[model samples]
Target: MAAAIAARLFPGRIYVASAGVRRGSADPFAVAVMEEKGLDIRAHRPHTFEDLEDMNFDLVITLAPEAHHRALELTRYYAVDVEYWPTADPSATAGSREQILASYRNVRDGLEKRIKERLGWTPPVSA
Candidate 1:
């Protein structure tokens, strides 16, 4: 969700890679929420930190403690910045269909805001 938002908000401005300590398929709820934002993340594959060793990253914003720790470990060998945003794991939220989707939507919206603010991006005026 964060990666997709950042990419859309700041296309050529920076290179963005999304990696975790563990790899898993993109969350369906996350994909659905992003689609509501007009961004298709169905093809976004989850990757681990090791999966991107050959790639260089300027900054890594981790939403979970485990990721932050792993990214800090990455800093031991690579010159990169990591920031922890302490985001809520929407998947952990328990509720009905609409209520559950609300959780995903909240995460999606929060990530969009943070990505815009942290990366200093403002949408171009639509003419």
Candidate 2:
């Protein structure tokens, strides 16, 4: 979701990739919520940090503690800025479809806000 949001908001400004310590399929709820904001992440494939061929990122933002630890360990040999952004795991929420969707939406919105704020970006003007 962060990657999708960053791509949407920033366009060609930066290279953004989202990976984790573990690999899994992209969550359906995540795709749905992001689609609500006009970002299609339905085709996104979750990748592990090892899948990344480029370890020369100027900044690495980890949304979870385990990821932060993994990123630190992986980037220890290189000079890269690692930031831990403790984001909630919306998948942990168990409830009805609407309730679950709400949780995903919350995460999606929060990520969008954080990406913009952290990157010091303003929405592109639509003409």
Quote each prediction's TM-score: 0.93, 0.94
* Model 1 stretches astray by more than 4 angstroms: 53-55
Quickly count the clashes in candidate 2.
0
Global local distance difference test of model 1: 0.87
Expressed as tens digits, the lDDT of each residue in 57-87 for candidate 1 is 7788999999999889877687877799999
- State the lDDT of candidate 2 residue by residue for 1-127, as single tens digits: 9998888888898998889987788799998888788888878899999999889788999999999999999999888899998898999999999999999898888888888898999755799
State model 2's lDDT. Answer: 0.89
- Which one wins on TM-score? 2
Off by over 4 Å in 2: 125-127
Model 2 vs. true fold: TM: 0.94
